[model samples]
Target: MAQAKKQSSIKVKVQKFGTALSGMIMPNIGAIIAWGLTAAFFMYPHGWFPNKEINNLVNPMLRFLLPLLIGYTGGKMVDDDRGAVAGAIGTLGVIVGTDQPMFLGAMIMGPLSAWLLKKLDQVFQDKIKSGFEMIYNNFSLGILGMIMAIFAYFIIGPVMEVGSQWASAGVNAIIRVHLLPLANIIIEPAKVLFLNNAIGNGILVPLGIQQAAQVGKSVLFLMESNPGPGLGILLAFTLFGKGKSKSSAPGAAIIEFFGGVHEIYFPYVLMKPSLILAAIGGGVTGTFLFTTLGGGLKAAASPGSILAILLVSAKDAYFGNIVGVLGAAVVSFIIAAIILKHDKSTGEDLDAKQKEMQAMKAESKGQAMPEAEDAHESVKSYENVKKVIFACDAGMGSSAMGASLLRDKFKKAGIDVSVTNTAVRNLKDEDGLLVVTQEELADRSLQKTPHAMHVAVGNFLSSPKYDTIVASFKALTQVEDKPKQEKPVKKVGSIDGIDFSKVKEVNFIRHDQHLGTATMATSLFSDAMKKAGKTTPVKAVRINELTDDPSHLVIVTPAANKNLAVRYSDIQTLVVKNLLQDKKLNEAVEKLN
Candidate 1:
């Protein structure tokens, strides 16, 4: 168990680092596409139109604008706008001396510069006094930015140039040896683990850009961006797979092939680990064909969509590229079909796989293992959730698909909550918010919005959690909309250990393990009171945050009530059979002054 935990922790850290690296590049993909289009349409000799004047936009964009954008974004990830300024400044230093674009340098110096600036502010900001605060802030950032830029110019530029040369040489050597296809042995598996962007943008794009600058096109751009492998897997599932995996594949395939959201197919691969072989097979075949037939793209295809890949293909390489993509799909589809045919498991196989993945993901997040329960009965509350957010590592494809799925569910249920998607790093704590994240990213999402309700899912597209959320919300909506007999407010003369008039606030105690449950309970109780037309404010708070005042009413289970007695005497307390659905809560609400 200890070894497992250590390994999981290492994996999480690697994914996080990869996400950060790709995060810098992912946002700048539009700029890259623009450069690619410009080069393809207007470059003096090779471009379709051959316009020398307009072609000037290509090199400068790649050499200066793109790298600077990456640096600024990377710095902002570390410390917001000020960090963005410092990062761009530092990146300029690295670009000035190198003929090669400074992508690798920007990735390093941007975040490092911003981190240093943040540390300096933490140390000196408190000491700066009175009206001179503006002077301290300005001088501090200016001096630090200048120092970072100088350091990057002297140290980072030359180092990254050598590194780029070495990487390009390694790729060239692999191609020369005809072993390029075998690279998919690692690439296919890494893509499944959500490192596609890191591999594509963090490593391949910079190298491909360098190669394209000299040779007009490069195979590196197509290596990771090719949608063949994923399309193959999804097609296989569509034909031979059983259950929801079978039903969901066609849509997933469309998204993977045309939409260029490669992440749409990852969950399918994860459902049956052996399907990785199909991906590997497809990737190897595609690379082999591309290499032997001389297929290459003039620029990185941002989404690896068929249309995008073709749009950026070198004029002479279209045949090779098309053949490679189709050949990959055919080979992968055959292998996956065979695998699915030989397997004798029932339809429950997919569900079992989902449960296993969910368990592993829960363990990775250090969250409690998910036990089986009906969503309709298990969900305790549906109050004040004004919006639902689906968050993931990149906030690009997977989360967006999940958001769309839930939005459909909401529309069908007639629920009024807004649904959206964003990167986990961008999530903010807000009132009446419900955050949905893949299980692996749950811990980060929770940390970002500690007060909001959270749901961790294993499969973004088909997790049962979505159904549970819809059912719970629908049930509540029906209850609220249904006609009910008006009941007379009970006037309690007295109750043990209680002062009704002094009850200004109600709280549910939330400990580490039960924070989510407590949050739901508070919402449920608050909604119940609102239906009864009472106006008392209800909250979920840790035991330590609770005030020891007579006006605050704390509700808890018998176990928690005992724990609370040991900590405070002035506050009123109610012990309940069930914290979320106790009958006594309504009585307590009625007695409130």
Candidate 2:
């Protein structure tokens, strides 16, 4: 457990950092699109709507506006609005001190600066005298923001500038030698390993910005933003894969290719390691063609959508860029199909995917991978869980799909359980809630919901653990309880007004949420029923899980939801509130008997 916790913590840091970078870019993507359009059109000479004034908005937006907004987002994740202000101010200093836009630096420094202020507030917020609270809050933030701005300017800002020059020179050299395809050797694997955004935002974006600033366009933007490799892998899964992969692959292809959700296809590649070669092939082909054809986007495409690519492309480079993307996809698809077709299934593909996800997650954070037995283990009493939530960096894409998959599994098992997904940061530590997050973000999710149960999966889309997890949910003893609102009437070895023989499953119903008290009460009643010679199965269920099956007995508790009878009109519900009372519990149990 200790080792598992340690490894998960490492994954959290890496995933959270990735999330922070994404937070810096994804939400503010419109700005990226706007800038892309402005650059491709207004900024270029002889281009449509060319205007020197629109060109002026380009550098400032990259260096200041987008970075600051992203910083604000990252800081807000750590604290709130105060962090946002501090994050933006610190990022602003970086923008001022460097010609390079500092995409990665803004993401890191902004969050760090905000985190500092949040920590200060945590330590000093209560210590300040009540009369001076407002003064302290304002002055504290003012001083902290100023200090961070200065630090960013003198330290982070200038350092990133020098680093940017070195990275640009390295990339430029690779481009000049036509060895740009060699980059896919690292890029393809890293993208599948969940570093797609980091590479694009941190390395490629800044390089692209520098090049575009110099020559009005840069192929650097297409390095990882082409989306061709991912689209190819998904297409392969749709055509050549077996089992669930074949069924899920086509829609995944659409979401990834058109929706620009590249992460959707990651698990497909990770499921079959050989598929990485397909990704590499596609990526190399794409990059090589781009370099050969002089294809470059005026700015980053953000989602790597083909449409986004063309929209951001220089007028003459548009067709070439599209061809490169399509060419890469074709190459990747052919390779992936050949690989998946002839390669026999190991039946352990799910395990392989999980290990890959967790292992990459561990390596990214510089930690020892947790033992296989310690990974993706189920929560204690997971069967009794009221709900399962699949969470990711941004709640929208991967999380949503994971939730749907798990929901389907539960439905197939005839289980009525709540399965959902959300952004990790939005999670609340509520009772009986199980949070299933990617191994990379498990620790971050755990920190947010310490009381809630958590399970970390390698890949949300392909983990086989879902079956085991749903089985556990099925195993949670079916039990519920109702409070005693009336007196128990004694009968001769039987409850006077009820027929116990007619019942098979005795369901104890909670009026509100079950925190285990009602279950316990129902258990005591179950024992009492045995004492009274009843052979019926006494089970407990949440109000939410109560079905309209006519054969089962639902014992409703005090203040019980009246909607139960209304919803399950054909079923009989006995109102027995406060079942923990011995007389009432005994009588209730006798009724089940």
C-alpha lDDT score of every prediction, in listed order: 0.82, 0.73
After superposition, the stretches of candidate 2 with alpha carbons farther than 4 Å from their true spots are 1-13, 44-46, 52-56, 98-105, 154-156, 346-388, 402-420, 425-428, 438-450, 454-593
Per-residue alpha-carbon lDDT of model 2 for 1-593, expressed as tens digits?
56765765665576666655666666666776677677777763645788888778876776677778778877776766678788888888888888786776787788899999988977986465323444666689889999999999899988988887887788888889999899889988877766677677656775676687677789988988888888888888777788777877888788777777677877777667788999999999999999999899877887677877877888778767988999999999999999988968843465666666666655644554333234225323553467788887667667888899988888888888888888776786666677888765655776797767667776677666777676565555443445759877743222354455665677766322453566566667767776788787666554545555446666665456365743454455566545567464555664554
Candidate that scores best on TM-score: 1
Worst 10-residue stretch by lDDT in candidate 2? 370-379
Candidate 2: residue 324 Cα off by (Å): 1.7
The alpha-carbon deviation from the true structure for residue 227 of candidate 2, after best TM-score superposition, in angstroms, is: 2.5
Residue-wise C-alpha lDDT for candidate 1, range 281-381, written one tens digit per residue: 99999999998899998888988899999999988899999999998898889888888888787545666676666666666556654332333555444
Residues forming the 10-long window of minimal summed lDDT in candidate 1: 369-378
- All candidates' TM-scores? 0.78, 0.67
